[model samples]
Target chain A: MNPMQRVMTAMGQAEPDRVPLFILATMHGARDLGLSIKDYYSRAEHVVEGQLRLREKYRSDCLNPAFYAAVEVEAFGGETIFIEDGPPNAGAPVLRQDADIDRVKVPRLEDCPGLQRGLEAIRQLKAQVGDDIPILGSVISPFSLPIMQMGFEHYLDFLYGQPERFDRLMAVNQAFCVTWANAQLEAGATAIGYADPLASTTLLPRAFYLKTGHRVALDTLPRIRGSVAIHLGSGRGLSLADDFAATGTVAVGVSAQEDLGHWKLAAGKRFALLGNLNGVEMRRWSAEDAEREVKRAIAKAGQGGGFILADNHGEIPWQVPDEVLLAIRDAVERWGHYPLDWKE
Target chain B: MLRGGADVDELSSDLRCALESLERSQVEKVLEAAIRIHSPLEVIEGLIMPALEAVGEDWTAGKVALSQVYMSGRICEDLVGRLLPAVAQERGSFPRCAIAVLCDYHLLGKRIVLSVLRASGFNVLDYGRMEAPALVARVLADQVDILLISVLMLPAALKVREVRAGLDALGSRTRIAVGGAPFLFDPELWREVGADAMGRSAADGEAIVRRWAGEGAP
Candidate 1:
């Protein structure tokens, strides 16, 4: 089966030729290509080239050219500092006072230069390998926007101290997510990858997630065309996995610390689980050790069709040796296959 | 026999309330009321740090969100900023220290560690965030006895190798200690990155540094 079909089949809870792969290879690609992060974030050609080169080396189902989570905030008049090698980070809060909420409007794609560059890259990527593989566009989910605007600390204060204002702020961000996701769909991205690391219990209470984080995702994500994936899906995720699945997300990005089989049982077969591999271990451990981890995760959950092998969080590091990527690729090809009921 | 005969229970309760409210002014007011009867060290070690830790506990256990935790961190930073002048005066001739956050989301841990280091009687120098060269140069120049680094991501944690090599290149023997999310997730990261040791939180980090300093003290 083709890459798209493989992903679609697995996402649909049916058996495919093998479990599809969708590694978050954004920053890693930039570093490997030796492009300044400023250029990688602004130039579609660089992003497209980096992505294609990485894909050439290691086959994957998703082409995420833009993983800079700060673009939407930057477009919304938020301050950001572009580092030489790393992703751009949001500066001080955009909405300084309670009054700034009135000025909070959903930023248009055309208005956001950074996001526009990414969309253009996705369009070009589709034109190049669009038919054979799925191109996934990324957006920082509304729940994750607090870190962008008003900074993370102030964001928590806004969430708890001024509950009503926080709701209004999230409403503004949710609109942007909807508009942004729809535009990516229009731009030839077959899937929308929603990155909401803050939704986990590591940062929020389960009740708060179900009430605010889950609600925002449910209200908007389902409306997008093709597929959707929410990341950092651990931290009390086992209990709330169904709520996340109910958001119509086809894939869940969980950390390696998560029990994959538990997620398989909790979220059921309809959703594909992406990641469980520790990025630190992959970079720190030897090639053989990294491969061992890959095989171990596969052994636990690779049996079922609904699994996409990926790092738990962050893109794979550039410092990782090429042999490491090849080793993981080989493991994916060797062990990440379906028909679990097969007799060895 | 406290400095100003302040009621420890009453001051602790009030200070805790101020920090929970997350307003630096309120925290300042609590400090003002306490300092009349308490020494700066007593208030910081007794009142401010305890409140911040309580809030940190709430944040760690998920009763409070990250934003609240960040606010508590900001408040601690403000309190430390206010107290540093007196702290500097009091801790004369203490061992000099330097700290750098190698990555983001470091404000909380950095502040906590700074306060702890000062409270534990170290002359703390917060270098804030810096590139590799500046980080290495500052450590070498100051002859920083214990260099504490904060890293919040896997990439930054991995980048610790470069830091270790940089220190080696300069032939500086600054003992490096790492803290934050990456090390917390994988303790072996400390040894793997070739740091002198690892610290879990601000106080825990201070304790670790103290142990190392104590062992090294002639």
Candidate 2:
């Protein structure tokens, strides 16, 4: 089967030629092309070239056309600081006060240079790869975007202290999320990776999320034009399996802290699973350790398909060596096939 | 009802319950009642500190959320501010200590650790946010003996080595304690970054400070 076919088969809860690899090597593309992380993410052509090179080098099944999550903050008039060795971080928060919520409006996608770069990258990647590889586009969920807009501590205060203002901000952000997501779909992304780390139970109580982020997600996912994969990054989300399923997401990104087998059982074929590998440790992993982890992951969650092998955090750190990622690729090829040859 | 004669355990439980629910008024009431019964230092050590520690434990157990843990610390920081006049006198003679979010915008971890350390009467200097050079400069300027750093990402966590090397180059005797998501994700990350200690939780910050100060367990 082709790469897209393999991913589609897995999403359909059927065994494919092997488990599809969705390495979240979004930032590592810079290293692939010897471009500064800042410059590589600045232009669509650069991003596409880096992604293609990464895919060609690693032979992974997915191309992440998404840039750093901070780019979404640029829409709110926030600046981003592009580091040399890491993903760009949102600059000074845009929403500093309660009144700023009233002032912050959802900007046109074309107006935001950073977001435009991402959309164009997705379009270019789709033009280049066609339907052979799944190109995933990402948007920070409305609930999570506020973290970049108003900073984490201030955002949490706004969330807990001022309910009405928080709702208004969510309304503004929700509009941007849907618009950005649909635009990505229009740009030729096969699926939208709705990055919502705040929705994870690790960051918020299940009850609180059910009322806030869960409602926002349930409201936002369907508006997107294509399949949506909910990514929680480092956030633990196993307990929210049913909650995620309720959002109509096609897949949920699992954290390394969770048990993959238990997550599969909890998800119950509702959506494809896309992680649980500890990305932080990948930088120091030997080839044998990488192989062992890949085999263990496939053994635990690759039983009946509906699994996309990926790093749990939705990103591979910049420091991870090429050999480590190559080891993961080779290991997946060795141990990711179906028909149950691996032991528990 | 703790105004009359509430025990520390009961007060701590009430405070924890109020904090977990994000009810600042209820938390204030619990604090008021505890303060009425005991000295401010006693209330902080016996009630506020223990309650916040419980909240941290709940967060670790996934029984509570990070927002709850963060807000709980914020609320206690506010309340503890009022009690600082009384608590200040109890500050033990220890090495100069400071904490900062090193090259990371995330401050929730640093905020919680600062609150925990202050509540424990450590008199820690809050370095707000600083890059490695600024942090090293401040450590030297203040002659800080122990430096606690928090970072939420791998890049910032890796920057800890820069902070360590900067201090070492200056011939500073500043010991580094590192915490946050990266350190928690990789147990050896603190060592990899040349930190002297790793705090798994906010409460761990107080223990590290106490150990460095040659003090007994809290």
* DockQ of predictions, in order shown: 0.26, 0.79
RMSD of each: 4.6, 2.3
Docking level for model 2: medium
- Total backbone clashes of candidate 2, pairs 3 or more residues apart or in separate chains: 0
Q: What is the lDDT of candidate 2?
A: 0.86
Per-residue C-alpha lDDT of model 2 across residues B1-218, encoded as one tens digit per residue? 12334476677778878887889899888888777768777777677777777777777777787777777777788877875555766665668888999988888889878877765656888989899999999999999988899999899999999998999998887889999999878999899889999987787777777778885321
* TM-score of chain A considered alone, across all candidate predictions: 0.93, 0.98
Query: Roughly what TM-score does model 1 have, to 2 decimal places?
Result: 0.82
Which regions of candidate 1 deviate over 4 angstroms?
Answer: A28-37, A78-85, A91-93, A96-99, A223-226, A233-236, A341-344, B1-94, B103-108, B112-123, B140-143, B158-173, B216-218
lDDT of each residue in B99-129, candidate 1, tens digit only: 8877554354675567555543457789887
Residue-by-residue lDDT tens digits, candidate 1, A151-195: 654566677678777678788888888888888888899888888
Question: Model 2 chain A — which ten-residue stretch has the worst lDDT?
Answer: A335-344
